[model samples]
Target: MARKASLSGFPEWLPAERVVEQHVLDTLRRTFELHGFANIETRAVETRAQLLRKGEIDKEVYGLSRLSAEDDKNDPNALALHFDLTVPFARYVVENAGHLAFPFRRYQMQKVWRGERPQDGRFREFTQADIDVVGDGTLPFSYDVELALTIADALSALPIGDFCLRVNNRKLAEGFYRGLGLEDPDAVLRAIDKLEKIGDEAVAKILVEEVGATADQAAAALALAKIRTLDTSFVEEVRALGVEHELLDTGLDELSQVIAAASKRAPGKVMADLSIARGLDYYTGTVYETVLVGHESLGSICSGGRYESLASKGKKNYPGVGLSIGVTRLVSRILAEELVTAARSVPSVVYVTLAHDDSWHEAQDVASALRERGIACEVASSAEKFGKQIKYADRRGIPFVWFTHDDGTHEVKDIRSGEQVSADPASWAPPASDLHNTVA
Candidate 1:
């Protein structure tokens, strides 16, 4: 079970729960590395200007300052905790552009701070796993499809059930809005993005009153947003709407290619979700939002898009495609829903029993032998009775209890069963499945 956080948004898990979280991190790292993403980490703090330069996220940024310098407001370049990894990565790439290879593949897993209200899966502090491929000048759109496929492959390896990676193109959306005579396409996209939260009727009202969309234009925008398909049928559906623009044609073609590649590479895991308007402004082309099939209320478990202008030095631009998984949110849902659990809380597979105070050294020898054989174990803390030591192993969920006889032989007992056998510390080992903690 998960414990309530002493601080509302900063979650602290019990030892058992931590096993699941650690497994998730390790799995994601392995999956990303297999796809050739080099792991890197940036400082937790970036200059306030550097963070805000990427987007208007001032309200969510937490300003950093020294205890004694709290009142010193004269510094123009104040430090702040980064709200996301993408911005810092952009900065890092530009600073290290000279040393890095073109189309650099990187994976970053780190904690990010955001001053948002706490809710079921939302938090002020959370871990984000981001993978991106950045190019020196212009990046091909093929990476967009690759990112979606990679994320689907990674998530499929986890215990999380079914999920869908919703793909859309910013150019397609903005182009379609322009065809509808909606001059402020971004405002229209923002309003449409809330269609799931606020009903279609509410979104239409916002379009008319706030975004200056005519009733007909609002209806058309909503109609386009409602168009979702698993195949290239979305292209025909958008064409049926009778809206046309050069950019819209380009977006439709790009999205169709993505859907086509996904069909051959990762079917069912990818879909053309027209309503997926990522809230981030930097997404210049393809955008993605993923939701667990049964847990849609948890919102997007993974999201990101292509950014053509986020990272630049002088005339050089590092265009890239990426995706970020909200590690904390996904783990929170897994625990709250009791989706899975660890085989054992601690990593110890064997516990060495102590017969007496003098036997402690002998038990240490046994533990050393087990460690050298690539087995995880521990020695009894005190020279308790045999029954008390066995009980301690059982309580700790250690599978085996080792006993050293008065002479020279050693015997190990399976705590879960009444099975005892003579064994040698140098050769005995548990089954392969019991060698390490696993998700159950």
Candidate 2:
């Protein structure tokens, strides 16, 4: 029989890699909770109409129905797996509006599905960590800057390498396109979004051929897209493009304000990048993308933008802004590059060994004592020789091994440093820092 194939886009990791994943998830949960952001989860599926409201993303929606059941055929357009967290979140807020708190601050970390061709760093199934705040009435403009800065701080706290947050505003791009005498401003914005994939020359060609731009005008627009800087210097640089656009100026101002606010809290983390035109129809204000230093080619590991009027059920208007970190991508890159490694396999702080049948119960007692003290411990099951037991613990990456003797004595051994010390099981304690795996 042929070997069962591993699904293309569904990625799985071994025990050690899973340790890294757990660490990342734990860190995010702890940090978000510390900052007072409440956590919530919504179902993975939404109505087809809701998913298709933003027409551009329709290609990635994974529509679902019971394959074996005949009763579901009548509801053809009923359910589809969500492509991103933002849309589902909007639907969630509207459904539970009466029960939620105003200015509701929420953080959701879960798997989102997309029916797209799988590639490096892009998966059909992946995890996204999103943070957003929605108000009962009008959301404060300051929350825009606040959300961006909070996400910046969260990403900065991760063990991954240094990252730069590239921010831009939609109004600025729309204004510039409108000022250029383009009839459809959104068309121009969409063209600019392709700057990373299609080079400037191709984009210029498209602008002239498809969007009806003069050669000089197209060249100037392309030049503006190419202009990027680490700080607010991007403002002065884009202005030099000589494109008389009011929207560009407004965008520049918003970018400046957000950068100023973020810097005040965590200096030198946010930068204005004129090239970051996130290709999404919903983004109406500031946008964000994070790139790891020296690994720019890996593409954006975290991205989101502000959206206005997302909560309209064809009537009510609810605008909100937020960001999401591609946790799977970030962790994958770190592991691929060997940037971080787990210090141990299991969660046990110490493994109590059984030398013989007579000492097995004693070993269990010692492990129990350790567990009572808030330490994780596991007693070896087999009554293996002392040398073999120690080797077993070392092979599993169990850092500290406690060998029990019939005389109520124990020997603690550190596998990594090859150090062993005699101790009394009732009174011994591993240093607080050694209780958990330390990233090296």
Candidate 3:
């Protein structure tokens, strides 16, 4: 069973819960590696200047200072806990530009800290799994499609049942708003981004009153936001609005390429959602937001986009496309709803039982032999009765118990089946499914 955290926004999982989290991390690592993405880890702290380089998140940043240090004496450029992985990665790329290859492909999975209100899906400290492909000066558009497919494949491998990888192009939304005679497309995008939180009526009011959009223009913008399709049909849907701009044409073409490829390749897993404006102005091209089928209220469990100028060094720019998975958020929901279960709490597959006081040495020998054969087993702490030892193993979720007899013979019992058979320590092994703890 899991317990509540004494500290708000900080979660601590029980042993069984931890098993599920570990399995999730391990599975993501495997999938990323299979796609030839090398793993890298950044420091947990970054200078304030570095953290705020991309956006002004001062309120959400936790400043670090020595216990004896006074506020006035602290360095003007003091360090603080990193709130996201992208900023540190950008700084790392620029500092190490000479040593890295062009089109660097890396994946980072580490804890990030944010100073925000504690809520059901929000946490102060959580793990994020990120995969990025960066290039020197120029990054091809195909990478955007590749990232969508990669994320789709990774998520599909998990036990999370169904999901939709919503793809959109910033150019499409901005250009559409401009064609509709809206001066501030960013403000319109911001308003549309809140459509899910605040319903369409509220969004329309914001568009008309705040964004300076006429009623007809607001209606037209809302119509575009309502467009969603699994195929390239969204092109005609957007065109039906009778809006046109050079940028809009470019965005429509770019988005069509992505939806065409992703929809065909990852059928039923990808959709072209025009309302996904991403809220971030830096995303120049494609943006992605992912949601579990039945858990739409949880918002996007994963999100990211292409930033053409995230990092730069002496006039050269590093453009990249990436996505980050909210690991802790997903795991929390899984545990809270019992979406999946762990095969065992512990990794031990066999429990080596003791027959007598002198059997310690024999038990050790058997354990050593089994370990040499790549089996995991633990010897009894004392020469307890066989029943007591078996009970201990059962409590720990161990499947098999091995007993050494006075006649120098060995027998292993499957506790779940009550089947005991003669066996050799050197060769005995459990079924493949029982070899390790699994989460499903």
Against the true structure, candidate 2 reaches a TM-score of: 0.92
lDDT of 2 by residue, 167-218 (tens): 8888887777777777676777778888888888888888889988889777
Question: Which has the better TM-score: candidate 2, or candidate 3?
Answer: 3
Which model, 1 or 3, shows the larger lDDT? 1
lDDT of 3 by residue, 341-371 (tens): 9988888889998888888998999999988
Q: What is the lDDT of residue 377 in candidate 1?
A: 97
**List of clashing residue pairs for candidate 3:** none
Arrange candidates, best lDDT first. Answer: 1, 3, 2
Clash pairs, model 2 backbone: 175-247
Per-candidate local distance difference test: 0.92, 0.80, 0.90
User: Global lDDT for candidate 2?
Assistant: 0.80
* Clashes per model (N, Cα, C within 3 A): 0, 1, 0
Clashes of 1: 0
Off by over 4 Å in 2: 1-5, 70-77, 238-246
